[model samples]
Target: MGGYDGLVVLVGVALLLTTGRCDTSCGGTDGSPGVAGTPGRDGRAGMKGEKGEPAVKAEGPVDEVVLLTLKGEMGNRGLQGVMGPKGYRGDLGATGRPGQPGRPGPDGKNIGHGQQSAQQGHSAFSAIRTDNSLPRYEQRVTYQTIVVNKPGDFDKNTGYFTCRVPGVYYFSFHSMSKVSMCLRIASDALNEKLGFCDYNRNNDQVLSGGVVLQLTARQKVWLESFRDQQPSTDQRDTRDKYIIFNGFLLFSNDPELHFSLCGTGRGGFYFPVCSVRLPIMLHHFVLVIGALLSFAVPVKVAMESCPAAAMPGIPGMPGLPGRDGRDGEKGQKGDPGAAWAGGLGPQKGEKGEPGLMGFPGKRGQSGEPGRSGEPGLSGPPGEAGEPGTVGTQDRAAFSVARGTNEYPEKASVIRFTKVITNINNDYNTETGRFRCRVPGTYYFVFHASLEDRLCVVLKLDQTLLTSFCDHRRGRRQVTSGGLAVHLSQDQEVWLETKDYIGMRGKPTGFSIFSGFLLHPH
Candidate 1:
């Protein structure tokens, strides 16, 4: 093994020594370097060579120059090494530009609400009478100035509202007259009158009345005067200032029921037959389709082979038997019945003897009870009764308004001077307190208008019952508070500012303090 190792080392040195022969030998410059050849295929690994003996140590000194010269140009890079470990994930990529917007979708269909709105069933009418002519007895008051009459149900010429839809309606009227006036709201559907309004004051008088009625289609309603002196209208005052009639449908009972008066104004009564209305859109669509069909098929042939009218519906069930009819008039006598069957052809039979009278016959079970008797006449007035005991007159009530704005000291009672009402003089304006006259529960309320902050407390004899506060920046504010408290006789209650005093008063009574006795214990 030592000899073989030495032989291999000497052979490698000889190759190295011959590699510089071009530099040492006298040879012309070398030709251009040859092109790189394609790499050779790797040979299969051979069996493991036997381990050489331990390297022998050389005895002479090793030259560093020889070692340096033995090194050759780096061999071609070894076959690509196995793939390295996966690197750390790279930073997130930049955001991409937005794409062009997609085309708009087709137009959407109109969707109707499943539930109908409350405003859809609107039916209202308003009118004013400006004519000075007085209507005759039992005549309708004509309102020529028609303010609003939706659906054209009101007849200004006849002064009657003929119903077009069945629903509950509210009717109201206001009349101003100096002379006596009496009006009646009448409906043809009902036997009794709806409402009445009477004003008999010699001075200017106003009267108003309202009524709610359930009306059916084709029913006529109007305001009429049955008395001799009807409500006089003013020709000067128009513009709905007086003698105005208004009516509106509150809610509908049936939305689809419609009627058409047939054979009206005949010798007999008029009958209104019900009808159903189809959608206008549906009718238009059906007409279009029919026109197209008529064009597609020759009109001459279509008309020649026209279909027969639809067969009538099956007859309804038979009704119940009618009531018995009245008797017919008697016929004329028939020649005296042929002289009583040959007159006296046969002789009269012998007269029979009279039978004996029977007893009373036990009263015949008293027959059926007689009907109730008519009401008796009212009796004369009775004598006057004795005088009764007097009621407790212990009452307390007051309503006062402030006349000016006040910014009182802290914890001061608010003085209300302008007294609107003071029952039994229980509220003292000087002290700004209501001294209870009767021991009972009393309710007190106060309203204050302010431009700044305000905190008020309702005090019952120095004990606060409740507090109210209103704070706003720019606009005026109003605050109201109420409380019911039980008070003994002479106990006082009043309104006062708690910490901040802010209040404004007006002649219109914007600030008010009122208290009333609910009951006396």
Candidate 2:
């Protein structure tokens, strides 16, 4: 290899003449041109000790010096290098998410529509035009225009006709307004309103139109006088022209019609400007079929009409709408979804849902206590039942018990005296109650006691069975059919009670004998 490249160029010029390091690159010289490198550190450390020294090959020139470099400047922008290592971690950033909500749009066609406008009746018929704002006048012209809103300007100049015959109608309009004989209208036909005016002023201002009443079976509509004609800078009478109409008449109001007006004046002119033809009032068509309500849909008459070019209200509210800004931080709770254990891999979202008992679960053990009751028998002696009423007020005025009763009626009246009377004497009373009506066996006798010691037997239901009768062989007259006693279909065994102290000298028989019986003993 040519002596191993001339002994590696004289051992790199003897190690650059012994390390005087001439700006390194000690290889391709010839002044300056790039791409030719590698030869320093003393030409590779003295070519490892001159391998064979008999090689020279590197003529003159050993010192080097040229250091003012200038190569396209774009460097030192570093420090930006560390970011490169982060590349492999990219996939995890895709969570900038939430873009998946855009697919729900086609359900909009509710497309509902309906519109009708012919405001009120008559709408138009003509004499020269006059609109009497109401009574029964309703000028609905979806075929032209006249509704000036209120009687303020009176039907604006109502006039139209093109219906064969249905019946009932009267309408008008005799507008004068600084006149140009105006009346522009069009909802679809009679295309007229080109313009004009001149209604000579002097306050005679005679222009009237209105009658509307009864119009059935309608017939489209058509007519025009758009009245116009004074277009020469009209100020009314700017060279007055004559009359061209007077045979027109239409009205509806008739609030008991009594209306009438008259006019006359021709100083240099033509005549015949009074006209009429209008109707829609049998009560304004019954107030338009009583305002057809069922949530109203009459829409005046529905459109295929009102379109003179319909344009009145919606084009973005005209003004005011813009204030909102200052709300930014409540967004942190979202990251727990991707199975959150460091990211993207779904598998742990299931523990939460147990709350809905505002109140209902404590009545399950009260249905099992129904089984302990069966031991009872032994009863057969009961009869004495009835008596119950006669209650007009004798609880003790006289006495009565056994199922309760003792009605010596006359309610609060017991003023019957006889025996020196006066014991609780609200007055004295003694119709002597010994009432014992039939159930046999009774002798509660009161023989006006005071007799030489008598028999005493009082009973108000102890059945005085004085140990089953015989009340102990009293002074005599003590009776009790005893044991044959059966009483219960309203049963009562009675006699006087209380003040009944008949033991010693037994003279206590208070007497009322007629009310007692029972000697069949």
lDDT string for model 1 (1-521, tens) is 99999999999999888766634553433344444445444444445555333212233333335434544444444444445455455454444445445455444321113322222445789999876554455788887799999868898889899876565566667777655455666787555553333334345555554445667778988987655333344223333224788887644453332224643323322356556788665333333333434345555533233223333444455455444444444444333111223222223334445444433333223334445445445544444432221133544566676767566557888888877557567889999999988898887776665556788898887887889887653434445677889999889999888777777765221466777766678
Question: Which candidate number has the best lDDT?
Answer: 1
lDDT tens string, model 2, 1-521?
A: 99999999999999887555433423332332334333333212212222222212234221212112313334333232222222222222223323334344443221111211121222322232233221111233222233332212122234334332232222222344333333221222212111112233333222222111233333333223432233444432433222211111122222111223433224422245566879766543334344554675565654332322334443333233334434444333322211223332223334445433344333333334434444334444445432222121221111111111122222222111332211122212343333322234422212221212223333444455432122222222212221234332234433333322221111111122222222322
**Cα miss at 153, model 2 (Å)?**
21
Candidate 1 residue 324 Cα shift, in angstroms, is: 99
Model number with the top TM-score: 1
**TM per prediction:** 0.28, 0.13
Candidate 1 has a TM-score of: 0.28
Go through the candidates in order and give each one's C-alpha lDDT: 0.61, 0.28
- Stretches of model 2 off by over 4 angstroms after superposition: 1-165, 180-198, 201-204, 209-216, 221-223, 226-231, 235-521
- lDDT accuracy of residue 406 in candidate 2: 28
lDDT (Cα) of model 2: 0.28
